[model samples]
Target chain A: MTLVLFVQHLANGLITGGLYALVAIGLSLIYGVLRIINFAHGEIFAVGAYVGFFLWRVLGVPLPLAFVGAMVGTAAMGVAAERLVFRPLRFADPLNSMISAIGLSFLLQNLILQVGGAEPRRLDPFMSGVLLVGPIALPLQYLFILGLAGVLIAAIEVYLRRAWNGLALRASSQDLGTAALMGVSIDRLARVTFAAASALAAAAGVLVGSVFLLQPTMGVSMAAKCFVVVILGGVGNLPGAIVGGLVLGVAESLAVAYVSTALRDVVAFVVLIVALLFRPQGLLRGA
Target chain B: MLALDRVTAVYTGRAVLHEVSLRVAPGEIVAMIGANGSGKSTTLKVITGGLRPVGGQVLLDGEPLEALAPEAVVGRGIALVPEGRRVFPRLTVVENLRIGAYSRADRNRYREDAARVFELFPVLAQRARQEAGTLSGGEQQMLAIGRALMARPRWLLLDEPSLGLAPKVIDVVWDAIQKINADGLAVLLVEQKAFAALQLAARAYVLENGRIVAEGPSATLAADPRVKQAYLSF
Candidate 1:
């Protein structure tokens, strides 16, 4: 019984961590490129999950199909947000931009609530069953999420390292005005970054929905966790988010196993504070 | 060939450039000289499409520039090496150059242009992978000009290329600017260092408090009493 409980909780934690890393990496990418925190990012994730859920429920689409749709759909939303909201506010005060983000976040959440209602929404398991390896049993869904997250991170890395558009994004992020002088459209690159980041968040949200309960207000908690992950990893650091997520996940699992189940959320926050205390910038921060 | 036709520009409803018109013919180096707040930089901003002109027009090859975006202005073969050497601090030297070709569509042509920049500034070739922010100020300035060159612009707008450089380094930078102009790229040079600018440009404009106070052949302007009194501090 003890062994089974430990494995089950570990699986849960790893799956959750995978999703957290996805969202955090997205946040970091946007920060790296735009020099803006994108406070509406988590809401974009929430929007993705809702879209995936509705697609599954109404269209009876398969999980993979719905995931793709949710990602593309949320990416479009991000692009539109960039075009309509952030772009107009580009030269405005940074604080005003942040406030606008908060406003947009709340507006998006309430809109979801209006459409989906206050009732908690959950998706029936899109994939089930466990693989028993000797004394340990692992859920296949955990492996799927982890695998997808790995691919996404790798793809982004390759793009940044080699692709033309990626090169432009990297340049623009360092100095937007100079980048413009270089003929790089800082505005268009920003729009692309926001779109890609939002899509990634949405994909993670959709995946997490299959493994956890979903609600319109779910984004607030996830958004907070994504911030913690980015902070723990160091803002604008990509690989740090992955390592930080895994560390947080394992810590959470151990706390749940050795301490108390109700203390799991407390464990994550405590880990964050302790991490910040030791290295204010983050664990992987070069400074 | 780039020309500003009675162009006026404002910031926050206050005029910064009042009907200031200037021109740089193909392969010519034209300098605009003024003290701080004399609207020298403002003229470059309007020419580069960084700021819109409220009155008249900015023309490149006889076409109105008011309809174009800044990036579109680059597409029309005008590149601004902005003041202060605003190189992307976090990007690699090579990455900075690559972005100069952002408006360009031909990848092969871009590669050739980058090679040409490397030939012009071999130091950048040596530090291609180094971050721009980490480079010495002179190196950063070189990277900035190299970045502008990567766009293969026919009209290059340079703002204060000698602002904060050692005399020897300024010579190197000025030589590179001259070399770029000699290679058939017309130049609009803005400078606070009146002597070096006057020596380099064939024609020059003197701006004072947001208006063109004088314009002539560089020799004539340098000999003018007002330019000698106000700008030449020797």
Candidate 2:
């Protein structure tokens, strides 16, 4: 293959990799704090996409505002999930929560199907045209995804490092009982964590919807890939999720480029199997 | 006063604490000495609202402290330095201290309290930016106690401060506890090491099988023949 072709795939890889990182980071935060895997996380993404779609297409809101609205909408959804499903089940069997999340996942998907209909809808791209440099041509939409994702990821890192609530979240993840002793409002933090996680997932949904089909079922595969990313990054590890998302994204992009386009989704399963078999401790150190 | 009046605690299906009564008056150091599984930590759990009591009242100055979350307990001016020196390992020393001040309604005292913590354990100031996990065991214990002090607590409850530490380290911790108590903050020091516990406190309670077997002034309990034969023999 030509070097130009390789570079195009690399850019494409980064674009999709950025989206995966966004979703995985949310999954990691929720799992890190609560020690619960939200199977409905992908469905939260679908909710975000639809929220954005509704705001922009139906209400004629601006695209950027639509993105913000989607985040807010999904954050509320996260809070509800925390208060209604996760919190009551906090002391219950972890399996019960997972099953509850699965139930939530199915419920959201069907609700979307009922409201939006089974037909796939398209979210118009905010920018048209490509950025040309030497032999490399990157679509402006893809570049927007890369830049926005970078900004969002950096913001999350800074918050975790510098913010009061963020430090409490990190501390609670390490030792919940000690955090309680320190006067951390565990229930409040859990709700906040859930809202933040949902918001991040929703942001991903909006970003992906900009350039791809906004289908009710799109989150199913995207979430499976995010699960792979979370596993690769180490469960509940933030930095791991970032790295794992990019790795999976690039691996899938290369698979599509060098192998077959059909293998793009299957690559995540392969990576999941390999990661589980070889490094179940995760690729990072946190959890 | 911080008091447990006929407190009963159950773990799983078994009652671990049965009608156990104890009290710590303002600015008084009260020691609770017990063997392993004698419900020493359970008492802390109930006081902090980690375990909801099946019976009895936990009172802070005669205000009911039942069903309150651990954060509310701290707001009411009581804090616990739990066993095992559980400093949030990945967080830096300063971050751990900040968490201690999280529930403070008076936002202004945080810096003052933090300065006092650093004074109490100067090594913590030296390791301010380092992650807690990288510190030695002794330093971790100091950080744990220092972390609690950041809240400007009126009553500090310690659970086995001497667990897995050298004698020298224990001395440093005890010295800090005495200094903290001298500052007019009440301390309820729980320990398996009766020698240090009895020496530091004005009064002591002996816990056995989740019941208060004997309690009196520290000197009186220290001289008791039953206390010498059973507890101090260790």
Candidate 3:
């Protein structure tokens, strides 16, 4: 392939990676503070897409308002999942929580299938077309995804650094017992973290609906890819998730460019295996 | 005042603290001394709401403390500088201190409290922007205490403040403990260093196999033959 083609693929992959980071960051945050790999996280993404679809397509709400609605809706759903499902298992084994999350994922997927039907839904973009930059033409929605993802991720970093609740969240992730002793309410933090992370997943869902065919099972591949990103980044490490997502995205994009679209999805798995075998601690060590 | 009456903490169905009882009055320094796995830490856990007691009660000024959640316990005015100086490893020192004030109602007083912490340990001020993990053991210890102080707790519970420190570092910590106690913050110190613990504390409890085996004034415990044989042998 030409250098121009390679750069084009690289840019596209990075855009895809931005979306993946949105999903994986939530996964990482939940694990960072809650220490549970939320199996149902992908479902939250799908739910976000559906919420956005209903608001924008059906409810006639504006696209931006639909995005907000999706985030709010999914955030509430996440808190409900936490309260009804995970919170009850707080004292239970970590294995039990994982199992519960897996169970919850299936339940949510099927529930969405029942509610929304099996047809693949589509979301027409509010604005479309591409920006021609020299030799490479970049889609506006893709740029939107990358820019928004960057903003959201950076916002999280700033919050964790500067905000009181955000600071407490980080502290809680480090040491739950001590965080509680210092007056960081475990219950409240769990709810808030779950909500914030779920909202990111929802936002990604809205973006996904803009470009991809949305179905009940969309979260399966998305969540799996995100897990790959999480594993690649290192579990519970924020920076790792971001880098891992980007790396996986670029790898997939390049594989599709050189090999075939058949190998596109498999790239994340390949990266996951390599990461686990070589540097299971992750590409980045600490947060 | 904080009181534990026949509190028993079970870990995986085995009692770590079997009917452990203790008391710390206002503005007093109380020490609980024990060997490893002797339930000194468990006793603190009971007080801090980390581990719920299977039996008995923990009272804070006659209010039931054990019934409350861990964070609720903090709101009720107790803070723990947990063992291992569990300052968030990746967070900056200022962030750690600010997080310590997570339970404090007066957000405006955070700056004032942080200033006081910096006054107590000027090292923390210099390292305010530094991640907590980078701090030396003594500095981390100071940060842990400072973090606890940010809560402006009625009672400060310290677990092994000198766990892994040089003699000089321990001296600095010991001085701070005295200074805080002098400043009228009640302290419940759990330490393996029985000698120094007794010296700093006004009243002390000797824990053995999850039970309070001995209790007396610091001087009396220091002089007790059995206490000396068991704990103060060093």
lDDT of 2 at A40: 93
Residue A22, candidate 1: how far off, in angstroms? Answer: 1.3
Q: What TM-score would each prediction reach against the true structure?
A: 0.90, 0.97, 0.94
| Runs of candidate 2 exceeding 4 Å displacement | B107-109
Best by DockQ: 2
Candidate order by DockQ, decreasing, is 2, 3, 1
Candidate 1 per-residue lDDT, tens place, B16-51, comes to 999988888999999999999999998888877789
Tens-digit lDDT track of model 3 for B30-56: 999989999998888888777889999
Task: Categorize the docking of model 1.
Answer: medium
lDDT of 1 by residue, A1-287 (tens): 78777877777677778788888888888877776777888899999999999898888998789989999999999998888778887778778778888988999999899988888887766568877877777877778787888798788788887788788777665666666666667777887798778888888888888878779988887888888888899888878887777777777887888888887778778988998899888888775
Q: How much lDDT does each candidate structure score? A: 0.84, 0.90, 0.90
Residue-by-residue lDDT tens digits, candidate 2, A1-287: 39999999988988899999999999999999999899999999999999999999999999999999999989998999899988999999999999999999999999999988888887888788989988788889899889999999999999998777888899999989888878788888898898888888999998888888889998899888999999899888899999899989888999999999999889999988998898888888544
Which pairs in model 2 have colliding backbones? Answer: none
Model 3, residue A65: what's the lDDT? Answer: 92
